[model samples]
Target: MRLTGLLGIEHPIIQGPFGGGLSSVALASAVSNAGGLGSFGAHVLHPTAITGLVRDLRAATTRPFAVNLWVPHAGEGDPIDPTPHIARLAPLYRRLGVEPPALPVAPDFTEQVDALLAAAPPVISFVMGVPPRWVLDSAHDKGITVIGTATTVDEAIALERAGVDAVVASGSDAGGHRGAFLRPVEQSLVGTFSLVPQVVDAVGSPVVAAGGIADRRGVRAALALGADGVQIGTGFLATRESNAGDVHKAMLHSDAAKVTVLTRLFSGRTARGIHNGLVRELAAHEDEVPPYPVQSGLMQPLRRAAAERGLADYVSLWAGQAAPLTASRSAKDYFKELVGT
Candidate 1:
């Protein structure tokens, strides 16, 4: 089925889910109410929090909306020493007037899945990797649409085999974490323009083009490439209703938005954002950073402090290459502009 028909939305536009507290109920419900799928990235929330989040979205919009999760990769639970990683970031911690926090524990993915299933939202989306067969079957049993993200053609094929209702062809130009699971992220960095048509041809499931897409022009381009829909992040993120920090939003509307570089400094996973001092200084030592959740936890205190002080340097200013095309507006207005409603 086409994305719109399958998802029960009027337009084939999905508001890309934003993890790390960037997603907001206001932003999501606004887009959903405007005839598009709105998504909330719940990877960081506890299981109970996930339930509450769904309830909040439900209270706000009668339309369909999606709750997104990051499928845990292998070895994600393994213990690793954070000493070296902490030492490397000590300077930044001091500069931010904060101390390195204790090793943080990531929310259990299994528990999160259980909570989501119980909540039974209209749609569920996964990134990083595919969910187990039982989970997919259960979601379908409950009449929920399931979407999986892919950065490569092989991954798209994998998602189709996994029986996902749709696949988001997330290219390297996407902001936030790369969802490359079949191979290393470096090997999966295909551009959106190159990826969408290939994925559309590779999978029988509907294809949603993501990455570097912020306006109707990009939406037309994606459809031209045979995509069934478009998933937009940076564009919706710049809207006033989004939960992004003021400094981060300012950068999206500035000249700096024109240049984004992928780095693992913030979360120990490759994510694209406006090139800033923190990214530049740590460019050489990216390999030394600890794996995700740990690196992400380690940086949280500093990132929080930086945001409080309005310091964009230390905050994770995640944005895509199309960020320069973003404008400060309400998400509802932006949705209208996107589909010409």
Candidate 2:
């Protein structure tokens, strides 16, 4: 297929990049060596850390791999008070025996882009929004393959216009933060089955289907829908090689995973995850939560403390709706099953 040729991999499977410390070099390299496109999410990392991450991944595997970033969207760097959001989570903080953290300073996007370009990885993928023209031009000059994420046909067209090498059709069923940018996330919640073909038809770039895909069946379905490849997240996140904590991985294997929900409580942005106490308690005030990075920063201390203590209730259990279908195994084995080889 075009995606396999474009990515120079034997299989057209891409391991969905996981941020917030869920991605690992071992996991990424394993998939790349196994002839699939492995990815590391470096959005939350500093510029130097991103360079180090690329170096580690290159050392682990000689095959092509991708580094994912979030193109800073609007309002991401705006000054906002976190006091009320902190007050809202006061109970959870007290329960976890952690204090509210100070406001967080997000890493500069321009600096990150420069660092990534200097590292010159084989492929670069973006979500949330498109990077500046200079960033794209620089990547092409370096012979780097650029991929963009889209939740709708219009978004896919936008990426194509921006000259991306490939476009990932990220459906609403996907886990982690929503990548919607052109419109409100609530209006962009299209299912994978419906979104993939439309995106494939709309964009000249190869289309990669994401969201609610775990096993061989999902892969085949995506291919039938004209997708050039498939990207699986929750499936890989549940694997032993992933950096997700034991509690988070265990929850994916349980019945709790079957009851996934889209909520903004975790990071002030809409995302799908296995429903738990935190989501239920804050369901009433989701609209009042501070925007991302702010809410995400305020909850960091509590999430960390809870995770250290093996408490899943307070930790963000990011997973797709296909969590129940996820099997715990090595990433290589999971990739083999996904490609049915």
Candidate 3:
């Protein structure tokens, strides 16, 4: 496959770069060493943590891997005071026996980029939008491959025009935040099968299909639809090597996984996850919540407390629509199952 050649990996499968600390060096290296392209999402990390994470990945495996960043780090637009949002979440924190959450400052995208370039991972994938021309030029000069995530064919065309080495056609069925940058995510809700061929026909770059893809059959379908590779998120999240909380991992394999919902309750951005209590409560008045990262920040205390205390009600159980189909327990085992090795 063209993606396998470009990424220099044996399998056309790519593990999703899960953010918010769900991604781990252990998980990424496991997949990469197994002959697939592993990835870690550095979007939720501080600049210094980003550097350390890349260094750790390099030390863990010699195989090619990717470190992902949100092109426009969350909370970049007109600043919204998170005071009211924090107030709203205060009760939740109190119930969880945690202190009120503090407002969050946006991570410096420039510093993170600089750190990423200095570390020089084989591939640097980004979502939300395309990187600037100068950024792409710098990555190319460093011999790093730039991959962009897109929700629509127009976004794919834009990435190709910007000179990305590859584009991930992220369908609405995927977990976490939608990568819609050109238009509202609702308008960009094309499925993996429909979006892949359209993107392949629209752009010259290789396409990696994401969303609603968990097992080998999904991988075969992606390739048959003209995608050069497949990126699996929810499937990898269930792996033992991943940093996902035990509760979150268990939810992926439970009957509850069959019913996933898209809600902005966790980060003020539409993301797919198991429909739990908090999601049910906040989803009704989602507009009252602050923007991305702000709402995310405001709820950090509750999420942390829930995770530490083994409470699943307040945690963000981020999973794709195909969570119920997740069939692997570890990254190494998953990669072998994916490749039929």
lDDT of every predicted structure (CA atoms): 0.93, 0.92, 0.88
* Model 1 lDDT per residue over 2-109, tens place: 889999999999999999999999999999999999999999999999999999999999999999999999999689889988899988888888989987778999
- Between candidates 2 and 3, the one scoring higher on lDDT is 2
Question: Which consecutive 10 residues in model 1 have the weakest lDDT in total?
Answer: 96-105
* Ranking according to lDDT, highest score first: 1, 2, 3
Please give the lDDT score at residue 258 for candidate 2: 91
Pairs with steric clashes in candidate 1? none
Tens digits of lDDT, candidate 2, 1-341: 79999998999999999988899999999999999999999999999999999999999999999999998877787999777787888888887888889877899999999999999999999999877789899999999999999999999999999999999999888999999999999999999999999998888889999999999999999999999999989999999999999999999989999998888888888889999889888889989998888888888897888788988888899999999999889998898888787
| Tens-digit per-residue lDDT, 101-170, candidate 3 | 5576767788889999988999999999989898899999999999999999999999999999999999
Quote the positional error of residue 77 for candidate 2 in Å: 1.6
Error of 3 at 135 (Å): 0.9
Judged by lDDT, which candidate is best? 1
Q: Per-candidate RMSD vs. true structure?
A: 0.8, 0.8, 1.3
Cα lDDT for residue 302, model 3? 86
Total backbone collisions for each predicted model: 0, 0, 0
Q: What is the lDDT of residue 230 in candidate 2?
A: 92
